[model samples]
Target chain A: MAAAQDTGGEAAAGKWYTAAKATYTTLIDTGHAISSAYQLVNVPSGVWIDERGRIVRPSETAAPKNQELKIGGKTINTQGDAYVAALRDWVAKGESSEFVMSDAEYRRRVKERSPREREADACFKLAVALHDRGREDEARQWWLRAQTLSPDNWNYHRQDWSFTSEAGKKWMDKFQKTTTDYYPKLELKEKP
Target chain B: MVNRRLLLFGGATALTGAPQARATVLYGDREVELTTSRVEKGDLWIPFGDLPGINEFSIKPQGACRADICIPLPKELKRKGWLNLSGFARKVKQAVVNDGALWSFGEIPTLRGGFPESRLAPDFAVKDRKGDTVRLTDFRGRKILLLTWASW
Candidate 1:
């Protein structure tokens, strides 16, 4: 098993990595590069790769258990223990793993981005370049632009929110605006 | 046109004394001095922490993004916290070259080919807790579960 952090510096990532105590390969991606590569827009996403280097499963929310949490008085869906159980099944069963998605299903699930998403990506890159130069104001401009381009990408908003003190208020406002459909329902086929 | 060229050429020389000019980056007529960390495969690598502007587009899931624009990059180009300038330039269709001390990027290209489709996961290298380099290929023969999560 391999784990990578999305945002935050090494210090922040280290704090959790040290606590996990997992014997797997733990990595810190300060730049969020893994998020981009794996098409993960949020945290706790997972990809399953078989022994032949083929991606049996694409990025999806992977939770070990179901937990009920109230945020802003709203109940957020965190049900995915089935995914965890499926993972265990895959580890033991290989190709015959019931959790292994078919190639056609994988292709269908991996949605393609629109042209606007591509443009937002470019703007975000430019924004990062400017921000690194200690040009916060300029960076904010691009950040705003990026938000406008990819409104659904919570990471972009959350990462920027981390820089400001009003992150909680801002996130609450955003969260309130989201509908109940915000979290995609987990779809797992029953074991045959 | 002449004034722009002068701005480009003059800025290059005037920046010689700036400490950040240790690694010069030229993008079109705008040349900026950036403190670069390392050079790999002849391309300059910019640390993500040092370049916050990249956050606008350096998302892994959506590819490099900027102001509502995103271009899927070959998964092979990503290396931990650093973005390969050459690989990025190629994905965005920009020309980038390293001349020993400086890195120059030409005009941004209009045409872009999205990331290539492949059944195999792109190989990348990252550092472990012990600071030892770990490559994806190291687990070539093993079934690996690559998971991404964060404390926040």
Candidate 2:
């Protein structure tokens, strides 16, 4: 299952979907409702749902398998192989997998949404709505509010930044502010 | 002088470029066309139908609620049989963004916190590539690896 959070609607998502030729179920979340529901602050996140519809793992940074890339002459950290291995173990062993987090640990790992963060989501949604309606100036105001309210939600910032040249520069500035460990470390317990 | 037809075309292009107020309310999975109004002080107002009509939250005696969490509303927030959504939002400390035409209410805190205890995943419907609506509930019996990404 896949969800695209682009404000440009299904067409924007379709371009990539068509290119990938993915056989899995793909969906578009033009309003970013999934982000709000799952407490996802970034893209390329994954959630594991069991056959019974219970979440075994909450949203976490998920990268593709065996990716190798260099950015600005520096090697980008790709935990794709490790993540894929853990996922495979879980798939093979289900609930008994050591890769699965205990209920308490899972609850603790999932970040609590603060009032400011919730507000930021609302502001970002409004900005997207406004932008879709062609009220660019008003959308910009709400986008700025969203960014200020939830500085950590890169999706909100990046979505708005893609629309304007001025915002592009700000996105770069914020991106550079991230520490070396931009992706959260995925802690998978070894099987006994 | 340039052709009069060219001059008229340029004027029409500029007219279309100007921003216009849209009358729509987007909440949850619904996009409803609404008749929205602003108070004398510029506060936004929407019908009660539009509130619960689009988003997950409902207006109950305990105030606005979704699942277990409820944010109590004040008396002044309800006026003229319409909800001052912006006012109610402020009372609950939730963000409300209005563009003089469209009003959006932000998320409220969950009951158990942290995405609602990971019980049943909230069901949502979205269009697939072929334009058919695909729902989350459709995959209930199968294990799902829901991955979120973007083209950008």
Among these predictions, the greatest DockQ belongs to 2
Each model's iRMS: 5.9, 1.9
Superposition error at A98 for model 1 (Å): 1.6
Each prediction's RMSD over C-alphas, in Å, is: 10.8, 10.4
lDDT of 2 by residue, A106-162 (tens): 766776678788778778888887887798998988888988988888888888887
Give each model's clash number.
41, 1
Chain A TM-score of prediction number 2: 0.90
TM-score of each: 0.65, 0.80
Model 1: residues with Cα > 4 Å off, grouped in runs: A1-7, A128-133, A190-192, B1-117, B130-132
| Candidate 2 pairs with clashing backbones | B27-B54
What is candidate 1's lDDT per residue for B1-152, written digit by digit as tens? 55675476464322222122367664422345666556655666665554434223555477766666777766566566556666777776554544345554543434222222355665555566666767778898788888777655
**lDDT accuracy of residue A183 in candidate 2:** 64
